[model samples]
Target: MPVLEVRRHTMRSKPGQHLSQQGVTLASLIGNSTGPFDLVWTSEKPRAIETAIAMGYTLTRQSAALGNLPKSILDAVAWPNDLESISKIVRRNNACERFARAQAEEWRSIAGELKDNQSALIVTHGAIIELGAIGFMPNATYSTWGDAIGYCEGFRFSQVEGLETCELLRVPSHLQLIHN
Candidate 1:
């Protein structure tokens, strides 16, 4: 039982808000993820929207950066780069890196405003999760989707320096794999 859980929709042939067979798997995963969440944020892509719907969550808001992304780029990447892949792919021109940072910032800002009674669900890409996690584990970097999927990934942020805290839980056991 995690306080927060972020999942990448199983597999997508494209990058929009469309649902696949994975939706059922995702729904099951959400059911296992927890009883209910106070808020849910998702990217504006078809796949993401579909995933949110399948999971029985209402898509109240969308990340601008996510909506601006071109699906062609997402489809081209294999996801989860190893050392070799990192060597070949890491660069200043990496839009994914840029997007990831922006996404993380948004989530951080949103998390900061949370009240004690509120719990949130943020539906985003693997890269964003990696960027957010960077602050937690200085040495451990999320390099691929597989790494994200295998781990129940998320973060906890404390406001008032040490008093109030918001968490993002990534518990594998709580996730149910679904392909709509």
Candidate 2:
């Protein structure tokens, strides 16, 4: 099966648009164990692009659709909510739902382009990752998914019988740094 590993950008100092030095270190560590990915993608945001570079991958493409969401959609859902809360907003709010569907479709489109046994990596933001996962796997057990994804945390998606299945990806506890 083709695989897509989508992860949030690593840590950035507050009020900065780029990754911190420590973020580079963390991403490098994570990259060490990760892949020889067939393709790599990122949001156009500097932080997302930097994360992929730090993780030792070159950009295959960057998309505004992956990073930019309208202010209306941003206003409709609270930032930093848990998966279940975001999933609820996705169901009731038209803007959120539309954005979520777009995210899901983007993931599918990327995965569809991969050849058998190939894998891809996408580096994006927190809410985009969460919404995409929920959009792609609506019936998943959200409550067990805990809080919003942290830096370098996201999901791995694989298609089985034409349906997508997702699993959470997390920075190992030993590698997690305390953010001030």
Best by TM-score: 2
TM-score of 2: 0.93
lDDT of each: 0.50, 0.87
75-130: candidate 1 lDDT, tens digit per residue: 33344533223323323336645554565567666565567656566666654454
Per-residue accuracy of model 2 over 92-164 as CA lDDT, tens digit each: 9988988888998998898888999999999988788888888888899899998988888889988889977
* Candidate 2 global lDDT: 0.87
Clashing residue pairs found in predicted model 2:
none
Off by over 4 Å in 1: 1-5, 13-17, 67-78, 82-100, 135-146, 150-180
Clashes per candidate, residues 3 or more apart or on different chains: 24, 0
RMSD of each: 5.7, 1.6
The candidate that achieves the highest lDDT relative to the unseen native structure: 2
